[model samples]
Structure formats: structure tokens, C-alpha cells
Target: MSTQSQPSQSVLTEEESWELLAGQKIGRLATSVAGEPEIFPVSFEVSGERIFLRTKPGTKLAEVTISPRVAFEADEIGDDAAWSVVVKGRAQVLEREEDLAEARGTGLVSYLEDGKTVWIRITPSDVSGRRLVPGDQR
Candidate 1:
């Protein structure tokens, strides 16, 4: 038996990336604090060209306030293959009433009892994705 070194991966278009984001609910948020990097599982909603998430006042919120730049990623795994999408953008804390109202209309529900109602919007500058396939597919 022989083993292949590289598996096949298909690059997803921008539209496809956005579509995947809209369809997926759970994603990982990449942020940094005091030079250390961290990734947290987040529930997000896609609205137009921005991604919105609700988080309480905590480290994740504080880190983004100082850095602003962040990355959000979501993926799907199958028995034989997997797909991943990433959105690189800046995080902004929404405080205006209008902004909060608009985000509330998106049907965002928080599973935490800590009242994670602070809205954070990530404006994507780059959206990309890839779908991996088994070596046999190549």
C-alpha cells in the first residue's frame, strides 16, 4: 500500500464562503490579549457583510477592544472529508441603540446565563474557505 502526501482541497469562492458562514451557527473566534493568542467557540449570525456575536463583558471583549482585529472560523467535518471557512475582520462593540436594535432583529440567542448581551460586530476584510477531500478523490 502507498500513502499520498497531500490531499485534495478545493478553494471556495467569496460568495461560497459567505454562504457557508450564513448556514453555520457555531464558530471559533481568534483573538489576542497581552501578546497571547486565544480561540473561543462562539455562536454568531451573518448579516449582510458583517458577522455579529453576543458576548458578556470579559476577557474576550476586553482583548478585542484593545486590538480590534480578529478572525472567526467555522468548519464541518465528515467521515471522509472536511471543510473550513475563515473571516478576518475587525471587532467593534456596538453601543448605539439603532445598532443594537438591528442586531436584535437577527434572532440571536445566547445560551449563557451571564447575560451575554453585548453585541460585537466583525467586519470582514477577507473571506476565504477550503474543502478537503480524501486522497482518493484526487
Candidate 2:
């Protein structure tokens, strides 16, 4: 028997998207400031379908404060397959001490040493993902 294969992409379900988010440690957060778009690499943690990240007072925080709407993306590539997920939502700054304390318990840390004390929570309202697989696996 002979089989023909073709490269294909599949859209991940909402549950699958959340699963990917749960396992991902780092993602690019895209925000806009002064009509210019910017993307920042952020280490994050997932809790109850929401993402938490730590940031210091800087351009990222400033932009987020100006406009809470943002897009976040993460991806994983394998030998012959890959998948990517994107989240679109609003970023809310955790100002309350209790909220910050709770976010701190999620094990989310920053690689920068500037002391990123600000915690931002991204609540995804539209989460989507796609997976690419070699046709041979089909």
C-alpha cells in the first residue's frame, strides 16, 4: 500500500489553547503606545485561565497603563511539528497588596534585576491557536 501526504495546519480548540498557555513559561506581550506597537518578552504564570507577569516601571508598564488592550503570543517548535497560540485581552495592573501577594505565590519571576515589582494580570477574552504537522504523521 502507498500513501500520499500533504502538509497541513489545524486550529486548536479553546481547551487546547488554554492547555498550551498553562505549559508555556514565556510569551511576547504586544502593546501599543503613542500609536506605535511594541512587543516585550515576558515570563508568565497561568492561573485559572489568566496569565500573570512581572514588570518594572518602564516603557512596557507605561504603555500598558495607557492602553490595556494587548496581544500575547507563544509557540513551541518540535522536530517535525510546531504549534502557536495567541491571546487577546485586557491587562489589569494589580495595585492591591493582597492581589500582588497572591500573584507572587504563582512562581512567576523576572530575569531582569531591576526589581520588577509591578504585577499585571492578562485576562484572555479571545484565545486561539494553530498547530502545524508534517503530512507524514497524518
Candidate 3:
């Protein structure tokens, strides 16, 4: 008889989660409006512990303003393993000159050609991540 090890899933530490987040340039922003949920794909930058992204005046911006609480997710997949990180926090629009200037320092640009004039910052209250290794299943 032969014995084989199974695949495993594990929760990532906060530091590991942040590291994964910092490495990714794109994430999904989750927001709720009028008891409904919406997700927007955004190009983002991670500085320290916060996430920043640029947006135009539209659904994403409007929904975030209407409900400041939001969740952001980023993930990566490899041939042998996969991981995902979720950040839950409040989203704030940067209106102050200093904040706008700091956000600009991040050099975050929109993937779309549309003008993205607004800067939004997400300050996370909870950040968690999970990693799955497929072992031989790969």
C-alpha cells in the first residue's frame, strides 16, 4: 500500500496578507448600495497599510460615498498553489490637498483612458487571507 499527503488550505497572517496585497496592482472593490452589492475592478496601489485607487465620478465613487464601508480583494494563482486576500474597511474620498498630493505620490494610474480625477483611500479594519496548495492535484 502507498500513502499520499492531501492538499491543504491555510489562513495567512496579517503581514503575509499585506505582502500579497502589495504585490498585486489590481483588486476588486466591493460596495453596497440600497441593500444591493456591487463589485468594481480597480487598479490600485498599497502604501503602508492603506490601499489607494483613482476613479472617475461614477458608480464606484457614488456607491462608496453613499456607503463608506467596503471590502477589497486581491488574489494570485500559481500552478501549485493559490492565495487570496480580503480587506474590510471604510473608503474615504480624498478631498484635502495634502491627501490628494500624497495619493498622487503613489503614482497610481487608471487602466482605462477615461479621466480618473478622484482619489479614494481604503483604511482597513480587518484583513485576512487564505492559501490553498493543491499538492499532487496540480
Prediction RMSDs, each to the true structure: 2.4, 2.5, 1.7
Q: How accurate is candidate 2 locally (lDDT)?
A: 0.90
Instruction: Output candidate 2 Cα RMSD.
Output: 2.5
Q: Which candidate achieves the best TM-score against the true structure? A: 3
Which portions of model 3 miss their true places by more than 4 Å?
Answer: 1-4
Model 2 ranges with Cα > 4 A deviation: 1-4
Q: Give the Å error, residue 50, model 2.
A: 0.5
C-alpha lDDT of all candidate models, in order:
0.88, 0.90, 0.93
Q: Ten residues in a row with the worst lDDT in model 1?
A: 106-115
Question: What TM-score does structure 3 among the candidates reach?
Answer: 0.93
lDDT of 3 by residue, 1-138 (tens): 435568799999999999999889989999999999999999999987999999999999999999999999999999889999999999999999999988999888677858888899999999999999986732
- List model 1 lDDT by residue over 30-105, tens digit each: 9987789999888888998789999988889998899999999999988798989999999999999999987888
Which clashing pairs does model 2 show? none
Order of candidates by TM-score, top first?
Answer: 3, 2, 1
The global Cα lDDT (0 to 1) of model 3 is 0.93
